[model samples]
Target chain A: MPLPPSPPRLSIGAVAGKTVPRLADLPWLIGYAAAFAAAHQAAAGWGGQGFYSLLYPAAGVRLALLWSRGPRLTLAVMATELIVQTIAGIIVPGQAGWLTAANGVARPALTYGIVVWLVRHVAARSQSSLGVAPMPLGLAAVTAPVAATMAALPWTLFSPELTGVSGLRQTVASLTGFVVGDLLGVLLIAPPLLWVVHAWQYRPRALHRPTLRQLAGLAEAAVVLGAAIAASTLLAEIGLGVPAAPALLAVAWIGLRFGRTAGWCAIVIVAAIVLPFTATDLPVAERLALHMSLASIVVVGYLAGSFADAQARAQSDLSRRDRMLFQAERLKTLRAMSVAVIHEISQPLSTLAIEAKHLHEITVAADPDIAQTAALIDRKAAALSTLVRRLRRFGGRSVDEPSALPLSALVETVTALTRAEARAARVVVEVSPIDPDLVVFGQEIELAQAVVNLVRNAVQACDGRVALSAHQNDDRVVVMVANRCPDRREARPGMGVGALVARAIVEAHGGTVERVTHADGTICATLSLPRPGAET
Target chain B: MTLPANQPDRAAVYVVDDDHDLGAAVARLLCRHGHAAEPFLDPVMLLSVYAEAPALCIVTDIMMGDLDGFGFADRVRMIDPAVAIVFMTAWPTTANAVDSVRRYGGLDYLEKPLDETRLLSAVDEGVAWSRRQRSIRARTAALSARERQVFDLLVQGHSNKAVADILGLSPKTVEDHRAAIVAKTGTNGLAQLIALAR
Candidate 1:
């Protein structure tokens, strides 16, 4: 009989034409068909067609194909099944050609089609990517009986030997036998097939070659698997109550120890070796009991794989948070550093802005002093670039050896450097005659930084006058910078960085600097040091 | 070391900053704008000339050593109480600066790198403000002893009754003194008269 009008037909030929590379797809299709034929031929070799015992791998492969290839591959399944059964010559012994095809190919393929649809409905929410993760057990458990019952209709119709079992009781019994057999086949074969296909699809690259430790772990797992199977068989033969103990322990050990890949590998190895052994001469209840034992092991493997996935995710998440925190801390430090740098550089930038504005003013003035304005810009620019250079060489200054220097010349030189600033501010610059006999031993450049910081601050702090004086008393040379205080209300010193930096430099050079506020509110900063060959 | 007593004294800018070059540059810009400007590296110099009221507009920098811009301005208020002030700072003005400007009656608070147009505009407004203040001070100076007393007490936030109680006069007499104070100062209302007193 013809199939009742089916829903949307999904053909592998149509799918392959569109999605797959034709060149690659041709080889894959041929291989799928060969594997499909080979599983059937193997089953028949184990037992004749009349006695449909356990181990029907063709059903498992059919379900796998239906899932991985999608419903579009329905025609591929029917066509492949029809050809394989005809070649086996056991589809029907003396029936019409169409009758044989329907009974052999259409019957099993349609029943499996219904099973695939039922499993898809039940496992739709928890869908797996077929080979990559374990197929939901509910898919096979719910699909088995429906498939077995559907198979009985066309099955008894085509086979003349079972024509007497068309009664409802006979059909139900046949359905039961088919369910037990198909369920065993699917449980035993489907998981291992998916594991192999998944492994092949995602084979590791050459760059990720396993380490010796990983190889030793794999070897250890192999020894454990072999021992488990051997122990279970021995236990079953002796009629001990705990035949599944070894299987359950090995499943948990491999699953938890090495994660999903190793867990699936352990499951496949156990299924391949132990499944066929349980198929011989066993009563229905005993056979069913053995299938249940294997089913429980597969579920344990699934549980262990899930635990491994969760831990791996959590570990990666923790590392990501740590990386983000480190980056945030680095950014905060950079922001603080930039604020300090801006503070230092702002004086020069402000000077530039002022000078540029003044240049325009000078051009418009009657008898404008162009030369004076140009000189001012050039001087300010020089000061700015010098500051930049010093910043760049902050930690890398060449160590200079100290030598004796003329104290009078040093004072005169430092005063000359500050004269332009004093002239612009209209501040009086008074230098008491330096003592010709007073000299100190030190690095001139290092001492210059100390002197300039103090002198500049004095000029900035005085009203109309700043004075520089050098004197010698009792083997000690002293340089004094004095400024008339701006405010007489307790002469509060301005909080500029130059004073602090000057203090640090003077202290570092084995010299002492002092600040004093006179009763009249005139401020004095003095630097004193031991003259060469004289004690402090 | 002194300019003629009559030379642009009423249209002058006093540019005080700790950075001597910056002070000179600012003063030079004001001179180009036709205002006689004196550059002071130290804010203390303002104290010396503040009693003389030499500059109408004082453009100063904050963060000066010895005396900060606010301290200098406050002292300026003591000597020449009506000078217009413009503060230039390298850092962004904080909330404290806003409060200082409001409390001290400063004309403007500016940040550096100084925009030339904004600086020129602020100084021009400050010059105008200082002129207005000088005229108001002159008018207030013309008030009689009784009117001055009433104005001072009223501007100090004392009511007419409170001022009468303090000075042992009737509230009606205090109100008459207040009216005379407002008219002499050329103020439209008590608030304007009080601002003039300030």
Candidate 2:
């Protein structure tokens, strides 16, 4: 799975993992209920027989709450709605009975449970990605008609004037109105609300000030979408009817160019511009045509924005893989060059020592002063030789035949080579005793270089101690380098150049390198190689 | 006065290196210390004429152009099992050190710009080791199959009765074989035979 576009943040209440309402949650619940009831009352004016609302904005609030804030918040909001509505049925004049009020709360509750299950098990499971656009749009498309029919049936069945064969046409009209109204309401209102709630959930501590390019892009999107809305409304005014293709094209351009937030904003802007014209006592068929046109705009914007986001993510992944391959090639060339240089230098160093020793041997009795000078020269040459040998341990590229090397010996050599660096860093390198007979088939020097790189990285990163150990697990020998951090939150997440080189060498030997960060702050890198008989 | 590598009793020692100067200096140091030593610039060139005059000991560099020091030691051992070999390299590693003794039949692995005291001591031990191995092979060449079996068991600390039981022979027959083993190998007693076997 790919990483999410932005890191998700959770509210303190949600982070508390509370499944029941608390005293601290009272203010939030009351505010949510107020918003829900206001939208419900606005739809009630054209609500046919107080059931088939022409535009049900309250459906948007219910779905948004369930999707973003989880069940506890949604449930609390619904409980408050039920109490307020039941009291209003008693207090307000010309209000429906308590059953009607109760149905309002019960309908949203049922839809919330079904949408949650479908989003979790169906939408999220199918794609393995629940990005802002695709997941909510898919859920809305599936649940709208079903929820609308469920809410429309009770009113159609209970009314006395619309009974038996006389009521059949009215029943069909009511169902059609409810489905169109509910689908339009959800398609328009739910996505923008979901976007707002998601932005709030993952909001940073400091408000993000948009860059100059972002501000300029937003201005450009506003200008294009505004022209689209103005041209569509003008055409409707002049009796040409509302042509939706031009406006939809503008919204799709904004979505594909400016990303999800700007695209969804463009859809909302276009819908807000079209809503008033549809409300001017127009014919019902014309109004439904306008609503269907706006729904198409929303769907197009959602899909275009999703494809753009996926393309951006794939480009980033390809770039990172390219960088790792480049680093591995560079490291290989450097090792070969260093081995050549060291080999050339060492021969002269050998000649110098031999000459100094020969000088001391020929002049010891005749002149003590000359003999002492020769001894000092020989000592300096020896020091230079020691330095060259130490350099070879790290940079020597082996071209020798591969053999079955004992794991114990390999571990010992790696630890010994890295001991100086560990001591300088004030880190302890602990090696567990490996099995004497367990062996891996590879060139010893190269494998040591691979392991030494891992151990050296651990020593540098560790707070105190780095543990080095190896064991035979079935057919492979697993060598582990682990560092336990003092604080889990401080663990670094990615590999460095040395680690990439280690991975390249290990992989060439029919092995794998896997890194894992444990919950308790232990970061372990494991190198597993095939045993002698299981050689690749 | 010792001429260059012509003393009969001194035995020959050959030093092989790709670097002509280093190989010549090493051979010169060994000659000055009263041993018959000669230098060869290429390990491949040395291997061609090695069987014509097998040296008592060989000192070879590992990272040469053609055949490496370890490969050269393996070939030399095939030709003359009694000749001792010592490895020298500029880039020394634990793997190289372990392999010199364990895999290549090398007496020691030394790093170059070689320490004077350590190099001399290693060469001295290599020569003595070669002579001892040659003497042992010659001594054991005369033993019959039955006497060789008794010698093997006796060196492993088995008594005459144990050897007799293992070979399915009587104690008197085992005792006779052990006496023949000691006489053929020209050793003093059981202790001498055990030391020679080692």
Interface RMSD of each: 10.6, 3.0
| TM-score for each candidate, following the candidate numbering | 0.43, 0.65
lDDT of predicted model 2: 0.74
Give the per-residue lDDT digits (tens) of candidate 1, residues A1-536.
11111232347765455433335445545666787777766654233223354456666677666555444356566766777666777566456555644554656666675566655554444323331223433344336535655666565656645444456554554555555455545544555666566567656465577999999989888888779888987886798854877987897788777776687678777767656756566555565556556656765764575456545644554575566558758976875676567556766676775675456445555445775666567556556645543443342222325667788878777888888998898888899888787888876766777788788887777898988898886777888999888532211233344665567666676778878776445778888877788862
lDDT of 1 by residue, B47-157 (tens): 886666567889988778999888888888888876888988765434435745897677778766566677888888888888877887699888888888888888899
Superposed by TM-score, candidate 2 places the C-alpha of residue A468 at a distance from the truth, in angstroms, of: 14
* TM-score of candidate 1 chain B vs. the reference: 0.70
Which regions of candidate 2 deviate over 4 angstroms? A1-35, A42-55, A69-116, A119-209, A276-287, A328-384, A395-536, B1-11, B18-22, B28-35, B41-48, B62-68, B89-96, B111-120, B131-198
Off by over 4 Å in 1: A1-27, A45-53, A86-203, A207-209, A212-234, A276-292, A310-536, B1-198
Model 2 DockQ, alpha carbons vs. true complex: 0.39
lDDT, model 1: 0.67
Q: Per-residue alpha-carbon lDDT of model 2 for B1-198, expressed as tens digits?
A: 233455558757899998889898999888877678899998777778888998888989998887888888888888899998889998776678899999998888887657777787888888888888899999998999888888899999999999999999999999888888888888889999999999
Location of the lowest summed lDDT over 10 successive residues in candidate 1 chain A: A1-10
